[model samples]
Target: MTIESVLSNNRIIAATQLKDIKRADESQCCAMILMNGKLSELMHMPMVHKPLFIHMDLLKGLKNDKEGIAFLKEFINPTGIVTTKGNLIEAAKKEGLLTIQRIFLIDTNSLKTAIQNIKDYRPDAIEVMPGIAPKIVKALKQELDIPIILAGLITTKEDVLHAFEAGAEAVSLSNQLLWNGTTEAITTK
Candidate 1:
């Protein structure tokens, strides 16, 4: 399914730790980004009902190559992946996994470079970090047509609301409390 469809109604995506998979699976979050774990941990990961996206960069012992992408598809069978590396995004796409390129808004030059890289790699979606930055989110939404997911340092209901107001399709957070609709902010149409 498309990331946009996966994030449609309740736009919160649980950015989960391996240990909290059960909670995320049961939460109101429309989907999940599995942000951390060992390669061995994933081998034994339980099957969950929701759409799952693994963060390739943080997966220890995974080579971050085409081979690694193949293994993930065969084993965990994730719906997609989140990564900062353009090559991994490409690799994941080649392996038929939906891709989300994580971009850090460090500065103007970095943002320019990231936009170019995003054009080149062409991931299914893009996740902008430091979700609190409304202006930056607004700017990026103006520039790109792909779905935008805001992540990192988004601590409260207000932050989630601001991100949506700035045009984020969804917000990914590790906060379990927020995963169950505590934020209660609907995306503005």
Candidate 2:
């Protein structure tokens, strides 16, 4: 799990920029959209008005491009999370954007590497995944000062509870047998 485990209190939003904003579940959810996808397409979304997060990959492609920088500055102003490497993170920071790197899955070695990598960048936050147990989260939090947002494979209120219990601050979910609506979050601690 990653920073989503920590950042998402009961009412966290999964920032999205998808052209089709699925019916939003306001109880607790994310407003997410594809960075590469057309933002105008998002207008078709029923919940386009919701706060959304632009992915990092989208920014990476535009890295150091003046036009790309200007576009991001003007068009996507809300908080965005990017899963980029070190150099790209610096470029984004120069552009006044704080991005969180995506750590797809954490094994012992991978988690160790991610922790070190994130520490070097001191990103806005760090995300971890593949059903990371809470014990590991506590360890990571203690080892790294950055907030850890859990992502990947979360599927239930129980998963939310477990993540919180494991010391995660937020959680990201995408079609993992979990409820599809953003409002479907648990009243986590």
Query: Which has the greatest lDDT?
Result: 1
In angstroms, give how far residue 102 of model 2 lies from its true place: 0.9
Instruction: Give the best candidate by TM-score.
Output: 1
Clashing pairs in 1: none
Q: What is the TM-score of each candidate against the true structure?
A: 0.94, 0.71
Across residues 39-88, which tens digit of lDDT does each residue of candidate 2 receive?
A: 45433334344445566465333454445545665666544546657665
Where is model 2 more than 4 Å wrong at Cα? 1-11, 15-17, 25-27, 30-49, 58-70, 175-189
Cα miss at 146, model 1 (Å)? Answer: 0.5
The count of residue-pair clashes in candidate 2 stands at 44
Instruction: Give the least accurate 10-residue stretch of model 1, judged by summed lDDT.
Output: 180-189
The positional error of residue 70 in candidate 2, measured at the CA in angstroms, is 4.3
lDDT of 1 by residue, 8-86 (tens): 7688999999999998999999999998899888888888999999999999988989998999998889999999999
Q: How close is candidate 1 to the true structure, as a TM-score?
A: 0.94
